[model samples]
Target: MSKSAVPVNLTDRLSQFSELWSQKKVAVLNDYEVKLAKLKGEFVWHTHEDTDELFLVISGRLTIQLRDADVVLEPGELFVVPRGVEHCPVAHEETAILLFEPEGTLNTGDAGGPMTKVAETLR
Candidate 1:
């Protein structure tokens, strides 16, 4: 990717990013990739077999909806959805979110639920 293709600051990039559910990749590890996203409304219920997903709320409020439980996150708050567990997401107010998960982790989880986005890399 070109110099222009990279974001000067991932935090700064949050404002112009999509308010809907989507992943804008930032960095990576041997088995994981980090992404930043803006979330609002409800997402689909889904799960991942081999990878657990981490969620950190940078700003605003976010809610993780699971089959048996739900977690509400305020700014600076975080939660994890374990591997093979099903969960959905919802945000009453627009929220900035960060995630760390395996490289090929499916956004909609294993079944390709409705919240899935065609993930993208920053550089």
Candidate 2:
């Protein structure tokens, strides 16, 4: 669903989840999708060879652990991990994030594993 006809209140959607490392699709726009995820602890190291991944911290904090450095983000901050760059996302505590990526972009990227999900709509 597109938010063009209605406002998507992220805070409301986020309240419905408590699972860590799971992404829930909220809306779709053209070829991209807007998703929300609840995270805690550390995520697997992965990379999307075909598409850059966008991460927007909605609440709490997150750190994108790249091979060379760690990129930390606070609420309202956003970052795009370039395609093909190996990276891991770790959350010290419960964190909420919003992601904008191509429709079929894998959550685990090219490093698909058990954590990899067939991204689905939550509502």
Candidate 3:
């Protein structure tokens, strides 16, 4: 057993931040990072050419709009956007989500802008 093996309480971690669209790193697995974010409004259309992105809705609703269609997710639902697929996430109200992606994966992906942010580790 190790300190890292301690169970993480997602709700407690989520309460530590309030910035919309900003991701907070909660844990890590292999070369991946498990992140949490509070989202609202529309996000920039982007693509992660190297790896897929996973989004799990913890609360409220989220819509992942792809070039061909829109994938809507509600609480307890998850969606994966494959690599190289351009997508935008929109949430009509405040939505809490869990994201699993490779370490160093940028939030904005290829559409870097002011909205882009480095996922900060939660303390």
| Better-scoring candidate (lDDT), 2 or 3 | 3
Candidate 1, superposed: residue stretches over 4 Å from native? 1-8
Model-by-model lDDT, in order? 0.82, 0.91, 0.97
Per-residue lDDT of model 2, residues 1-123, tens digit only: 654777888998998887778889999989999999988989899988988889999999999999999999999999999999999999998999999999988899878889988666866
Candidate 3's residue-wise lDDT over 4-86, tens digit each? 87898999999999999999999999999999999999999999999999999999999999999999999999999999999
lDDT (tens digit, per residue) of candidate 1 on 1-123 = 986466547676675566478898877767788888887787787778888899999989998988888899999999998898888889998888899998877788766755667668864
Q: Kindly indicate the candidate among 1 and 3 with the higher TM-score.
A: 3
What is the model-wide C-alpha lDDT for candidate 1?
0.82
**Which pairs of residues clash in candidate 1, taking residues 3 or more apart in a chain or in different chains?**
none
Candidate 3 residue pairs that clash: none
Error of 2 at 30 (Å): 0.7
